[model samples]
Target chain A: MKPILRIGSGAGFSGDRLEPAVALAEHGALDYLVLECLAERTIALAQLRRVADPAAGFDPLLVRRLRPLLPFIKARGLRLVTNMGAANPLAAARRVVELARELGTPVRVAAVTGDEVLELLDPAQPTLETGQPLAHYPQLVSANAYLGVEALLPALASDAQVIISGRVADPSLFLAPVVHHFGWSLDDHERLGQGTVMGHLLECAGQLTGGYYADPGVKDVPGLAWLGFPWADVDAEGGMELGKIPASGGIISLATVKEQLLYEVTDPAAYVTPDVVADFCGVRLRATGPDRVRVEGGRGSPRSSTLKVSVGYRAGFVGEGEMSYGGHNCVARGRLAGEIVRERLAGEFAQLQVDLLGVSSLHGEERGAQSRPYEVRLRVAGRAEDAARAARVGEEVEALYTNGPAGGGGARKSVVEQVGIVSCLLPRDRVRTGVEMFGP
Target chain B: MKHKLFHLAHSRAGDKGDTSILSLIAYRPEDYPRLCAQVSAQAVKALLAGLVQGEVRRFELPDLEALLFVCEHALATGVTTSLRLDAHGKSLSSALLEMEIEMDRDIDTRIPTHAHAHTPTQGS
Candidate 1:
């Protein structure tokens, strides 16, 4: 058995920096590079794009991201895995093949599909968020099950150099290669759980390497401008050490690791992904050296019988308008502009939110005893059923310049069709997964 | 002595549906108990009364000297549906750090005096 397997995270999210990933591929000496690009609402929005154009559902940055790394994977024989195939994996796979051919680098690509289960969804099935039936949402756009390591293992087993998927669990993207390389059984929940700990730690790429951390005077992280992505050296037993390229910038201390360990995690004892119920409660981290931390003591139990499905539906439009007021009683002027908009559009929309950006936008309306600010931005936003109704909200806010509040400059307005996402649990057997191969 | 939670701890916020998950870790392990005592679920809910409309649950990880808070109905109504400018509630962590806590005593002498000094490398 291999003493240690090296896996590097390329991109944490859809819009993460491309250079860090290229740096990993060129310098990290990694056996596998996993780019976890899909967010909870990404696939639903991708589904909307697919409706507009059949071949446009994949991540927009897929080709731009792959263009730089194709040479390293082709030369070093390194494998690549990603959920960049947000709504369509086959098309993404085809695009990769075309890019490889253009670069004169021959490679095999695999597309993992069957996450989409819109047809199988029953209107009567209750959702997890509101406990309301699926029928309650008439404009349902998409339903996708979160696939696990099992879905990607077949592609890994194949000769495919690149594996593209849609809506796979984020951590599962890293865990699949570990399972395949070690020939670990899917039923081995303990090792799967330990492997999951490594996956969770590395999935956010730069986050593990101190990108999101750094509070100048408080928790200081140096060289963030050129922050390096992270990689894990995993052993057969699933113990690992997380580190970054030595020449790269960033810190890998207990603070960064501990903060990321519980990120988005509601329960450390039970972090449920598709493969296993990973127990991070007892996990330990030790700073072995500069830019390196050893992680161990993670355990797991049997996998859950149900898989989480993200349901996306059309939730109407959000109309927003912003205008600035400055110099002398700006707070009062901003509030007056907000009140005028609220009174003009009162009872017209389902919900209207007005706030003075400099003072009361983020926390809430209750501002207790604060000094007057020289400038404040008046922002008015409302949710409406149609685009025209939403546009009216911006029009009223813009009218504040001449009609109501003085010095209402730099006015900006936008109308966006919102896609709302909710979750539901479906039996694992209900969702079928498959893989397709493409080559130049 | 009065101290802002920001001086004692640092936090990061994340979102799932309409729920916001914030992890608060003490800068020093010795301060963990103080956070456990003062940063109760009730205290957190009351502090974030404007954003959080549901129950607040806190989970402790004594080993890491950290506290994880799960606030339901906190993201307005999830990221995509929420009309707030900060739909993901990413700034809520800073908001939570604004809480005031009455310290049991003055600063300890053992604490590093060069806390703000940015060393080039933490280790060789």
Candidate 2:
């Protein structure tokens, strides 16, 4: 076993930049580089793409992200682990193999499957929201369970240079390498939890290194545009020392670490993952030097017998239109423009939200007091039964440029189908995850 | 003086389903107690008022000098369907941090909240 394991973060979400991740592999000197490019709805949407074309269903930005890092990872002998496969791991693996061939590099990739639990879902499976039976929904686009590290053990055991997964837990991707590097058992909850903590911190890439942490004077971070990706050095005992790419601008203070530590986490004492139920409350974090923090004192309990599944179904469609109104009384004109669209789509729309950009947009009426600016953008969005009706919300908003409000211009409209998600818990015995390696 | 929670502490907001959890961590180790006492779930609920449709649950992590608050139904719907700009409620931390809290003594305003000299301690 290696004395120290260094894992670097690539992209936080699917659309995250490729620059920071490239910096981490080229400069950070990583043993393993992970990109967590999947979210709850992202895969469901990807599944929709797969329905249209068999080869589709993976992350749209996967090729661009992998292309830049492949040359570096290949030269340095760095391993790439990611959940960018989204809905189709095999197809994604095939695409990656093609990309490697074009780059004239030899690479090994692992494509794991069986996160989809749709086959096992029954009428009895109740959703967490209304606790309604799964059968109640006639249309379900996708249902994938959050798998654990065990599913990745085979891939890590092989000589795979890249490990790809569909919908495993974000932390599990990073934790898998730590387990393989240190030879940690699946039941080693304490050390697993420590490794899991490190995974959670780096899972969001630039978020930990001040991309999402900056607030100008309040929380100033230099070179946020070139914000470096973060990585953690894990010792045999599971002690994690966190830092970012060299010469990359961003701070790694106790505050930045603490924010990331608690990001997307519900309970500090029971941050549940498939590998372990980590307790972040007990985790200790301290600054070691500039752009570095020593993180330890992580603890955990056994994981739950059941794994959570994110199920996506057809909700409806969303239609939106926006028009910018400038000069005197812009807010009033914007509000008036919204009223015009509302009146036009009256009975057709199930729900409508009117927002005046300069004064009160996100909060709507709840944003009681308003600010009067010379320019205001009027945005109107609605829910409709079909895409055609949803598209009308945008049509009526565009019509306002000529008919409804004075000094109105820059009309933009779009109609998009909404993807709704419901969550359920499935027993461990029900899932059958397996991994296979592919190379060119 | 009425000081904003943003002035004395740092927070991170996250969403699960329709719930949004905000973890509030104090700048100084000694300031944790006041935050625990003052920044209650009720206060957060009151601060966000109409935005939160359900109950607010708070968990104190004295070990990290932090209090994590889970605000249910804060997102109009899950992010996939939410029409708001801040779909995941990423800005909710700033909204909660904007809350006014009464303080008796003046904190050294020179040091930023994310700045170091942080004394690490362990207690639950």
Which one is best on DockQ? 2
- Model 2 misplaced stretches (Cα beyond 4 Å): A364-370, B106-111, B117-124
Q: What level of docking quality does candidate 1 show?
A: acceptable
Instruction: Encode model 2's per-residue lDDT on A1-440: one tens digit a residue.
Output: 67999999988999888888888888888999999999889999999999999999999998999998889876887999999999999999888988988999868889999999888888687899769988777689999999989999899889888889999999999999999888999889999889889889988888888878777666788888778889999998898888886698887778788888888887878989899999887787777777878888888999999999999998889888989988887778788888878887887876788888766665446543546678888888888768998898899988886799788899999988988899999999999998877775
Whose lDDT is greatest here?
A: 1
Native contact fraction (fnat) of model 2: 0.52
Clashes of each: 0, 0
Clashing pairs in 2: none
For candidate 2, the C-alpha RMSD (Å) to the true structure equals 2.0
lDDT of 1 at A205: 88
Q: Using alpha carbons, what is the TM-score of model 2?
A: 0.96
Model 2 DockQ reads: 0.52
DockQ of each: 0.45, 0.52
Cα interface RMSD of each candidate: 5.0, 2.9
- TM for candidate 1 is 0.96
Residue by residue across A182-291, what tens digits does model 1's lDDT show? 99999998898889999998889888888887887676677899999999999888889888998888878778888888899978899999999999888877777778
Q: What is the C-alpha lDDT of each candidate?
A: 0.89, 0.85
